[model samples]
Target: MNLFDYTRADTLGAAVGAEGALLAGGTNLLDLMKIGVATPSRLVDVTRLPLTRIEEHEGGGLRIGAMVRNADLARHPQVLARFPAVAEALLSGASAQLRNAASTGGNVMQSTRCPYFMDPLSPCNRREPGTGCSAIGGETRNHAILGWTTGCIATHPSDLCVALAAFDAVVEIAGPSGTREVPMATFHPLPDANGVAPALAAGEIITHIRLPDPGGMARHARYVKLRERTSFAFAIVSAAAGVEVAQGRIVNARLALGGVAARPWRCLDAEAALLGQPPTEDAFARAAEQALEAAAPSGDNAAKIVLARRIAVRALSLAAAGTPDRMPALPASVFEGDVHG
Candidate 1:
């Protein structure tokens, strides 16, 4: 890593105005710096700030501090009981060692895992705009198959964000202009016509992530991930699903796809289709179809579109079945249960 000034801040005001890169767990920031993807002249450590509490929100939901570590949050009583999908997403991320150090804010702010953007030698528009995209006609097996532009086709790499988006979580931000809240749905935007992506102001610190009460959603939720391996691997395609059923009829449904686009691709259309329908193979298949109605391969990733749709159906089916009393021995694997659901 390059030489940079470092200071630890004990207060939110100090951390906000300290400028430079806001450092928390250093799980992603340090790696970006080592590879030249980030070159901050100063590092303001916010681990010392009072943003580590996981308190109950006014509306019977959760207010998760940004500094809460992944492992702790995953095992927290409230997270496990109320937002099991969120806990499952956290446990399925990285490894035990990295999870112990990674923070909630850091995970939400992580950059894309596209190799082209990581290589300083490559011409990546996300890294150096107007330089062109190297992944255009190159290796794209792990790239996006939905909502991608020719300028960039990198998929977001966050399991936590997928579950957060599906559940309608909100982000709390602090900066020179004071605090503001943003719905998680639009927090990570898809590439516009110009392919400019993501949404986070410079030097703004994510104070907390507020999760609204799931109500009936708590009893039925699941996050299913398809990867090259059982653990410690980024998803090839993943789905987060929550279902609320009344008298055998679907009342509320949430579906979001990860590792398929620049952000967690929430399927509002699919959710609408599932409303009032009974949770069954045919209904889930139809909803999955609506979810991928606009999806087209950005490159030679046509198979990803198929795989993502199947995962969506699989996730929704499992969620309708109801959450397991205990987390699976292996979190989120298709093999965790029957993949052919």
Candidate 2:
């Protein structure tokens, strides 16, 4: 990696003020720098600060510090009991060793894992503004299917982010502008017409993710990720859900999808469809259909049409059954249920 000035901030203010590229785990940043994709004059390491605590907020919600490692968050009792989807996503990522090195804040801000964007030779608007996107007609099997524009088709790569959107988690940011809260849904940018490419703003450091009180319903959450391998690969299509059933009727349902969209996708149409309906196989199928109504599949990923639908249905079914721990073995055609706790 290129030489850069390193500083460990003593306080939040100091961390926010001493600027260059904000470094947490350096999982993504350092990797990019090593490959010459990102070269920074300075590296502000904030992991030493006291932001690693995970606490129970009032009203049964969760307040997670930005520096909490991915493994710690996934294994925490509070996360296991409350946000099973979030925990499952974290554990499903990388290996145990990488998770131990990855911080919660770093995961939230990790860049899109597009192959062409990272390769210096390829044309990518996200990497070099106005250069153009090579994924549009190149090896785009892993590109986005929804909310994509001509300029960018790269998908957001974080599974935990998808689950956060499902639970309506908001991020707390303390920066040069002072403290501000950003809803998870709006935290990632969507593909737009400007052709300026899609990405989060520079210099914004994530400090905490504020999880809204699940209100007795978080215990029944599920996360399902489909990948080429059984584990440790980015999702091909994933679903995260918070669902509750009362008297055989669906009382509440929240869903977020990943891999198929440019950002964490909240399935509002699916939520509306399941609000008063019975939580059954057919109901779940219909909800999945409604959720994917806006999907526009392209490139070699047309199979995602069926894959995404199945994950959504299965995740909702498991949530309605109130089983966060076990499920019937997933078929070979679908994902193996190993990473989800």
Query: Considering every candidate listed, which one attains the maximal TM-score?
Result: 1
lDDT of candidates 1 onward, in order = 0.87, 0.81
Candidate 2 lDDT over 74-159, as tens digits, reads 87766776787888888888888889889998898888889987887888787777788888778878778788887888888999
TM-scores of the candidates are 0.94, 0.91
Clashes of each: 0, 0
Tens digit of per-residue lDDT, candidate 1, span 100-154: 8999999999999899989989988887778888998999999998888888899
Model 1, global lDDT: 0.87
User: How well does candidate 2 match the true structure, expressed as C-alpha RMSD?
Assistant: 6.2
Q: Give the poorly placed runs of model 1, Cα more than 4 Å off.
A: 193-198, 327-341
Residue 289 CA error for candidate 2 (Å)? 1.0
